[model samples]
Target chain A: MITEQHILSAFDRDLESVQAMIMKMGGLVEAALSDAAAALETQDEALAEQVRKGDAAIDALEESVNAECARLIALRGPIAGDLRTVLTVMKIATALERSGDYAKNLAKRALVLGQLAPIPGAAGAIRRLARQVGLLLKDALDAFIARDAGLAEDVRQRDLEVDQMYNALFREFLTFMMEDPRNITACMHLHFIAKNIERVGDHATTIAEQVIYLTTGTLPGGDRPKADLTVEGQ
Target chain B: MITEQHILSAFDRDLESVQAMIMKMGGLVEAALSDAAAALETQDEALAEQVRKGDAAIDALEESVNAECARLIALRGPIAGDLRTVLTVMKIATALERSGDYAKNLAKRALVLGQLAPIPGAAGAIRRLARQVGLLLKDALDAFIARDAGLAEDVRQRDLEVDQMYNALFREFLTFMMEDPRNITACMHLHFIAKNIERVGDHATTIAEQVIYLTTGTLPGGDRPKADLTVEGQ
Candidate 1:
């Protein structure tokens, strides 16, 4: 009943649909990250509450993406490029979902820290790290959409910068905690939220790697040198 | 030119080959983990060096497993179960590769610490955590090998325990560094290495999740109660 043209067109259609859904998910996550950062800035318990409620939608989206990928792979036997695209989407869904979790983590901590006096811009490192990671996520997804391996490679390089920022931020927190031991728990929570952001960056880098592999049939670690950085979270 | 029987048998052969290779990779990673622990206990830089050297072979093996999966997926056009098997193998290969990376990270740090002074049983926590994660790794692969979702679920539950141990170990290290600033650098390395081991445990949980998904067609996180742990990781 099914013809070859039908299958190819159907594959293309499904790929397009998946890409759109992923971008939508990316948009939601980006907004979540920004909102979480703003929540910390304003110590907005209400916005923090919203982030916790929003996580369920992100989780549902991830599940739906996986289900769609599975259904497509079953109904249509896609070839290398199509297969890679589906797999990449599936992997990115997990990463994006976790990024949402990171945002929620930050929001949760922000709520707790709301009870205390402000540390006078204690959230600066987290904001910078979140923004950097958000850009990486955007660029990685854009590269995938554009099928641009060069853009993907560039995103991979940016991961090192995030890693460096993560360590420096961690060191700064360590110094803060050392200066005031009472800040240990609060700073630790912030450190983990920052770590979650770095991990999101890593996952974006992973998507970039998959894009390069899909396009060129080679992984990027061979001759491509990773940027030198503080080397934490590896 | 390809017969149905040929395709089926080729799929079977390749799947079996991939399983074998995954188990082999798992074994190598376990050895590296154990050797790294031993190096820590005995201040054996030679053993740590050996683990570092052994990682290249694990890397090579992982590459082969990946290539084999790609080849099978391309050539055979495998069906539902066969396809999941190949995909799972690819996923497991990645988890195993990261396990090796963790072992290598531990060994690298052991090399550095061994040069500083005798570690003086600093390897205790690493040894315990490595063994726990190693067991989880083995059980996860076994579940994959036998297609046993039940065993995989058990591994998933056990991951919580490993995480708790890592957290406790981390807190202890944090306290050690807090008590004496001189321990900061060494403790930092130890903390990250422990974090990597804990992550390896989580990756094993992921493999288990894939197993459950492959068999039951349901992802485990929704509506399921969180695993009860005496010492929670987060």
Candidate 2:
């Protein structure tokens, strides 16, 4: 009993709802990552516990998104653009789920590394990396929400900074382990936590790329690019 | 103008052709990875050249597959299962492309490390790890082609072995670097090459998981609880 106008309106509503849900999920995941990093810095087991508990909510949100995406795909019979949106939502859900997993890993590593006395200044580098990745992740989602190709491209470019920091942190941690063999276990735990954050940055870049692809039929890489890198073009 | 039987036969032919292309691409990528390892071991620019050359063919195959997939999606109103198959093919193509990129990175590293007099005995571990992952990559695709859940599960389990070997190799390379500071660059190259192969193992695991999901409607992991070795997997 639905006309074309009704169908289009319903599709718009569903897309908005789905986007809202994704933002909620992304916020929760970002909090979990930040808390995990904070726990590492402060040796706070309670924050780690919060991160662990937050996974259940992330999982639930993911299941909800999947169900909604499935319903939209089945009902709307969308064209390539809608199809890409639905597919990107599904993929972003999975990416967020994995990011939650990484955050949990970081929390656990924090708890383990906390048992050791302290490594001065190591925690700050991890914190900076986490903050930068968090910004990238937020901007990537913002790009998706606004269909802002320029923002997505910026997010993609930021990934290199995260990688460079990760590499430097890895070497620093390696040096720490070598300097004091007793600190090996703690440093290794930190190494993995840092790696998890770096991977989160990678997933953020992936989401940005997907956004770029979804908006434009062409995938971003190599020349002959279609989208301009400024908000004015968006 | 076409009978149902004829249409079905065309689908079958198209499916087989796509699968053949994917397998061919997979083989070339695996060979390139193996050659990268060999190049690093033997300090052979020739083998590195082969890998770099092979990447062009992989790119060509990927483009062809992308075009065919687009045509099929546009022309054929594939149903749910068939849609899933087409979508999986696209995602699998991406995984294969990334695997090729990793191999290309390995080859580039090999070329750089080759000029600095190859480290003796370091390549064995890299080769062994590459061989294991190569086999896993082949077997994973085989399982996908056959829709054999048992084979897919076996490939999933085999990934653990590659992970173990990678960690062990990492430790050994660390020891080598610690013994001689001059070995640092060469050892880092070996580490990244091993890491690339290990990542290939991971991608194979991801593909196998997708195959399982395509059959069983459930993602991999979280089914049977076991002693989790990796910090991320638990």
Candidate 3:
């Protein structure tokens, strides 16, 4: 018969494996985000295609993480903190997968925008936004690995900056579109790319929130501050 | 000592209760979508506020469902198909919660747009799109309750129509903004509202996909046939 200690060790090993996969998935997502932003900045269609293709791997990792999570829960019957950790791993994988999708979308838009006249300053602003989101995602993953709720909260707070950047870009795009209708098509695509980057930040915040919940057993109180003034009156 | 049959029956009862909660949550989301669209069509600020306020209930229900799913998993130790069902329930609750948020966003935008000049045919098109998405959400939940994969696939396919409608509206809004800059601010808000409704359809499709995966151990393949031409040629 299998001993109790053996089962406990196996569960710990399983948990570590899942966590490792999540980190691997996070790495791929970070790379995709950077590449997508770089592709946009340089108007590199080939690099954009690479980011789009890379999404499938991230998606497959999510599927594996989900299966492993379900398997661990079924076979080990984890409770309390261990259970929360497993569930959080699943949630983090989901957030990472979504971030990957947003990156893919940005890359897809970059490919089309490459064919059009470049919008001055828009690509640079998008790259900065993507970099900020990348930093937030890195901190979110690190917090998850360390179970540091404070660091996770820090990541969550930074998302407000991302929203502000997105709102600024929104106004800038409106100005570009108004200056010349010829810029409208290109500006609209850039606006979407900016929006996609903002969404990546939101996903990063979601991962951070999951970490906070996993650590504290309670979500952060009140709504996270929203700095996106695009629809402020509403 | 508890017999095997006792544990099995208890698990069944737990599953039934979670499913009931999911149905209730779905009902609230459907109502919110309808009301948000109605408010936009009639420029009814009071109705919009009602839809916005109603979102809290949907969110609360989602929290309850998540807690119950965790409890069921910990207490019952469900495996294989039962485990998938529990996970799918949690996912469906999340999708429903997101749909509620989108509906709330639509209502919020409607409140702002009510003060602006009406965009010709835009409000009516949005209402029709919302109605179709509401129908899709209804069918997705029904498929979940009945374990009907075919119906879920049908819901998944219908999402393409929602995307097509959204793309058409995008062009219409672009025309309005180009013809008169006075319509720019209103059209931008309308564009966002339409985008939110399109996101609602996406969430409904996600729920349907989860239902398909729950019923059949495999997700439907081939990229789900997106019809959104906004970012086409990527």
Best by DockQ: 3
For every prediction, compared with the true complex, DockQ reads: 0.26, 0.21, 0.58
User: Model 1, B184: alpha-carbon shift in Å?
Assistant: 3.2
lDDT of 1 by residue, B153-177 (tens): 9998898788678767767776766
TM-score of each: 0.86, 0.82, 0.97
Model 1 docking tier (incorrect/acceptable/medium/high): acceptable
Candidate 2 collision pairs: none
lDDT of 1: 0.78
Interface RMSD of each: 5.1, 10.5, 2.3
Pick the TM-score winner: 3
Report clash pairs, candidate 3: none
| Candidate 2 structure quality by residue, lDDT tens digits, B51-144 | 8778878877877776676556545545566666766676677678778877877777777765555677777778888889889888888888
Q: Write the per-residue lDDT of candidate 3 for residues A1-234, one digit (tens) a residue.
A: 569889899999999999999999999999999999999999888999999999999999999999999999999999888888888798888789888989998998998898899888888899999999999999999999999999999998899989988998999988888787777778778877887789889888989989899989898887776787776653
Give the true-structure RMSD of model 3: 1.7
Instruction: Score chain A of each prediction against the true chain A by TM-score and list the results.
Output: 0.90, 0.92, 0.97
List, residue by residue over A114-191, the lDDT tens digit for candidate 2. 677677688888988999988989999999999999999999888888877887787786676667655555665676
Q: Weakest 10 consecutive residues, lDDT, candidate 2 chain B?
A: B225-234
Point out where model 3 deviates above 4 Å.
Answer: none
Candidate 3 C-alpha lDDT tens digits along B112-172: 8888888888889999999999999999999999999999999999999999999999898
